[model samples]
Each structure stands twice: as C-alpha cells, then as structure tokens.
Target: MSESHQDKQHKARQQKVKQQVDARIANATEEKGLLLVITGNGKGKSTSGFGTVTRAVGHGQQCGVAQFIKGTWENGERNVLEKLGVEFHVMATGFTWETQDKQADTEAAQALWQECKRMLSDASLDLVLFDELTYMVTFGYIELAEVIDALNHRPAHQSVIITGRGAHRQLVELADTVSEVRNVKHAFDAGIKARKGIDW
Candidate 1:
C-alpha cells in the first residue's frame, strides 16, 4: 500500500514537534528539588500526590505524608506505603464543616503541622506530601508564613507536593510546578456516593 498525503503531513508535524522538544531538553541542565502544587475544586488531588509518593518509593526513596482535614477512616495508601517505610500523619478530624468545631480543628491542624515540619526537616526523606493543607492555611489554622518558611528551609534535595483546593497565592507562586484539577463533572454531583477503594 502507498502512503497517503495525510500520512506525510502527520509525519512532518511530528518531526517538527520532536525537534522542538529536543531543543528544550538540551537547554535544560539544572537539577534540584521541586515544589509541586495540585489545587482546584476537582477530585484526585490527593490521589495524584500519593501516586507521586508511590513513584518515589519505587525508586527506593524515602517519603513522608501529612494528611489534613481527613477523617479517621481507613486509608489504603497509608496501609501500603507505611510498609514501604513512608511515614504518615493523619489529622483524623474529617472535614471542617462536618466537625463544626473550630477550636478542635485548629488544634488538630497545629499538631499535624508540627509533624509536617519534622518531615520537612528530615534530609533523609526525598519527598514529602502535604495533602489538603490549603484548608488549614485558608482556615487560619496554620500560618502560611510558617509553611513557607519550612518549605524554604527544607533540604535542597527534598521535593515537596501540596494538594488541596484554593491553595494560597503565595504557595502557588513558590511552586515550581502547579496543576489545577478542574471539576468538569463528578459522580457525586449526579447523586453517586463515593466508593471505598476508588474514591478513597
């Protein structure tokens, strides 16, 4: 069979893209720890962070996770990652609206932030994930300045991932890579309850 004109055009476009990508790759030489932020009103923010932690673990790198605003429910990631030596700290207070206790939520956030600080300071850990941390900062439970300071002082080789909706502007600005997961459509909006293994 003979090649079509459309096939030739596609090949030419791909060749051009390859050259552009190759040039960018050649120009990039620096290597260091990165701060990544995953924020928006969509689902899967924490899931994405956990996926990154899993990737690091696969590489035999030490990782830590601090989950804020999450209820004291069973966590599949914690169960698997802990066995791989990843330290995890859960707020265990659930959502703020559910608890409806400002004082207690603040107290829990502070305690969890302290644990996060320890993880950030640990040079042995290659990656640290702060899941749903934006709520704490926005709710005034944790100082944004303190979070920024801790991130700034973290070891040069330690990468960090922050996942939550409504991330602080300052935090977004500081992040090397920022991704916003927009909610186009969700099963919950259609009256579908969140499943255990899939949703959690």
Candidate 2:
C-alpha cells in the first residue's frame, strides 16, 4: 500500500508543529512558583483546584488548602488529601446567604485568612489552594490589600491556586495564569439536585 496525499500533508503539518514545539522547549529555561487563579460563574472551580493539589501530592510535594466559604458538608477532596499530609483550614460556615450573620462570617473569614498567610509563608508547602477565597473579599469579609500583600510576600518557590466565582481584577492582574469558567449549561438549572458524591 502507498500513503495518500492527505496523509502526506498531515505528516508534514505535524513535523512543522513538532519543530515549533521543540524550539519553544529549548528556549524555556526559567522555573519558578506560579499563581493560578480559577474563577467564574460555572462549576468545577474547586474541583480543578483539588485536581492540581492531587497532582502535587503525586509528585511528593507539600500542599495546603484554605476553604474560605465551605459549609459543614462532607468534602471528598479534604478526606483524601488530609491523609496525604495536606493541611486544610475550612470556614465551615456554609454560604453567606445561609449564615445571614455578617459578624460571624467576617470572623470566620479573618481566621481563615490568617491560616492562609501562614501557609503562604511556609517554604515547605510547595502548593497551596485557596478555595472560594474570592467570596471572602467580595463579601467585604477580608481586605484585598492584605490578601495581595500576603501573596506577594509568599515564598519564592511556593505556588498558589485561588478558586472562586468573581476574582478581583487586582488579583487577576497579579496572577501568572488565570482561567475563567463560563456557565453555558448546568443540570441544576433543570431542577436536578446536587448529588452527594458527585456535586459535593
């Protein structure tokens, strides 16, 4: 059998792409901590952050997490990660709407912020995930300047992941990488309730 013209063209295109990728790999030599901000109206923000934490753990890296607005509901990620020596500090105050207590929510946010600061400063922690942190800032429970300052002063080799609905512009501007998840469609809108293992 002989190769088709389409196959030939495909191979040529792939060869060119390979050359470009190789060149990029050769030129990229810098390695440092990365600040990744995942935010938007869609779901999976926390899931994405947890996936990265799992990756870091697989690589034998130290990881920590701060859940700024999570409720007392069971968290599968925390259950698994905690056994892997990943420290977690959760607000456990549920949603602001449910709590409906500004004073209590603010207190919880401040406490979590302090823990996040400690995690950022710890050189031993290679990766830290601030889950739902944007809510704290947006709700006026935490100071944006203080958050930025702590992030700026974090260990040079410590990477951080912040996940929430609405990320501040300042935080996005400072982030090395930012991903915004848009809500195109969701089952919940169709009267589907969040399942225990899947949704939570």
Candidate 3:
C-alpha cells in the first residue's frame, strides 16, 4: 500500500479506539468510594495497595493503614505515609509463622480488626488500606462474616483497599473492583532473599 493510504488507515483505527475509550470514560459518571480488592500469589499485592494509599495522600485525602502479617517489619512506605500524618498501625508480632501460636494470632488479629473498624467508622477518612488481611480470614484468625459486614457497612464516601493473597470468594464477589495479580516470576524462586525497602 502507499504511505498516504496507510497513514489514513492508521488515523481511522486510532480514531475508532479514541471514540471507544471516550465513551467508556463518559459512561462512568457515578461518584462514590470503591471497595477495591487486590489479591493473588504475586509480589505486588501490598505494594499496589500502598501505592493507592500514596495516591490518596497525594490528593490530600485522609488514609488509614493496618499491616496484619507484616507488622514487625521496617517498611519504607509506612515511614513516608506516617511522616505525612496518615493514620498507620503496625503489629509488633509479625507473621503467624513467626509467632507459632494460634490463640495469640487470633487475639492479635481481633485487635487489628478493631483498629480496622475504627478507621472504617471514621467518615472523614477517604481511604483505608487493610494490608495482608486476606490471611486473617483464610487462616480463621477472624470471622469472614464480620469482615464482610464491616466492609458492606462502611461509609458511602469512604474508599477501602484490601490487599493479600487468596482473598475469600465472598470478598471477590462483593468488591466493586477486583484485581488478580498472577505470579509470573519471583526473586525468591532464584534463591535470593527478600531485600529490605523493596520487598517490605
């Protein structure tokens, strides 16, 4: 084909794509907080959740974050977000495997859930990040029904992001936006330990 004809065809195809994208953007006009779930066995679940929290902070929106399984770690995201005056809480006991006590893990999870509820009830908070919370339900540390109820009853204008692996079926069903991050590769698979500031 001639160069001019190809250019015209390219322009036509691009115009069609632009129109479709414009229609999609125009059709989504409703304004409200979203219950977004980021789940899978990938490496970026918590990272993506924290990224959303940072975005909210960039917009001057209030954010609340509670790290369940990773409470004991020295985290870069927590350092910056807390420095910026975002409501952040961390558990000192760390992961359940480290603790190795089912009862204690359950108690700590309940306490964290109370903190999550406190943030959920706060209408002023624009976003809440429940970090590594999927394990709480999956491990039976907290009742799934309670979590569902709390999420369902959250303030109309308050957005929430739940990040962890193996999210409950009900949660996937309930979420307005559900993202499944598939695992393609990992540094751990190559025998490299998790690096600080990047992994945590």
Candidate 4:
C-alpha cells in the first residue's frame, strides 16, 4: 500500500476507536460516585478541587469543603463556593510554615479533619472537597489510618476530592481517579503575585 493510503487508513481506525470510547463514556452511569485525588508539586491542586465543587454545585448537588493549611486571606474561590451554599470549613490558622508550630498546626489540621469526617458520613452531601488535605498526611498532622477509614466508610453515593502536593501513596492507590498537575510555568517565579479571580 502507498504511504499516503496507509496514513489515511490509520487515521480512520483512530477515529473509529475515539468514537467507541466517547460513546461508552457518554452512556456510562453517573450515579456511581468515585474517590478522586489531585496531587503533585505543581500548582492548581486546590484549584482543581474547587473546580470540582463548582461542577457539583452547578449540578444542584449539595457540597462540603474542608480547607487545611490555608487561612491567611479570603480566597475568591472560597467566597464564591460559600455563596453557592457549600458548607465551608477553614483551619483559620494559616499555613504550617507560617504558624511555625508543629503542635499548633497539628491541632488545627485535626480539627479540620474532624469536620471532613462528619461531611463524609453525611449522605445528603453529594460531594466533599478535602482541599490541601495531603499536607495533613505528609506532615503527620492527621493519622493516615483514620483518613483511610473515613474514605472507605463514606456514603456510597458521595464523591470525594482530595487535593495537595506529596499525597500519600496509599491514598493515591485508594483513589478511583488520580490526576497529577505538572507545573510547566508559573508567574510566581517571575515575581508576579497571585491575582484575584485567577490565582486565588
């Protein structure tokens, strides 16, 4: 066969495969919820978590958010999500590095984790966002076993989203879908601060 003919045939075969995959996805049931983990050294882990929250709210699903290790300022995402009737819980102690106290950070993280636990068990909540929760496990602030237990015991139809850098391998393995956002470029490196509505 000529090279051009082979290329055309390959393209046609690829299109057929794509169509099959798309059809399968389109017909798939949306009722079965899954645990999702968004992790990596790159930015946007929390951003992705909030994006999922927005999607859930847009679908008229009740959502809950527990923010760990971030409480310095009023983030736009938090404001918008709260306005959408999302039950938001923030540590109010800021980042661990800024607190400069391991015990204090641990206590704060534990409190937030407690709230997350409650949300996980609430069947009425369709989605729960564990924003920056990986830090709790990474820093040994919250017990990994407890976290796993809560995840496993969550409402069957509840969709959970965990986001942060350096997520535990066990958590990633437990997740039904894992997405790692890689940082190709960031404005912070160029001395550009995080902007409202975009970075916050």
Point to the candidate with the largest TM-score: 2
User: What TM-score, computed on C-alpha atoms, does each candidate reach?
Assistant: 0.95, 0.97, 0.96, 0.89
* True-structure lDDT of candidate 4: 0.90
* lDDT, each prediction: 0.96, 0.95, 0.91, 0.90
Q: Clashing pairs in model 3?
A: none
Off by over 4 Å in 4: 1-11, 22-31
Better of 2 and 3 by lDDT: 2
User: What lDDT does candidate 3 reach at residue 17?
Assistant: 100
Residues 67-134 of candidate 1: C-alpha lDDT, one tens digit per residue? 99889788999989999999999999888899999999999999999999999899999999999999
Q: Which stretches in model 1 have alpha-carbon errors above 4 Å?
A: 1-5
Candidate 2: worst-modelled 10 consecutive residues by lDDT: 191-200
- Model 1 lDDT, full chain set: 0.96
What TM-score, to 2 decimals, does candidate 3 have?
Answer: 0.96
Stretches off by above 4 angstroms in model 3 are 1-3
Off by over 4 Å in 2: none
How well does model 2 score by local distance difference test? 0.95
Clashes of each: 0, 0, 0, 0
Pick the lDDT winner.
1
Check candidate 1 and list the clashing pairs: none
What's model 3's lDDT at 57? 93
lDDT of 1 at 33: 95
Give per-model CA RMSD: 1.3, 1.0, 1.7, 3.3
Clash count, candidate 1: 0
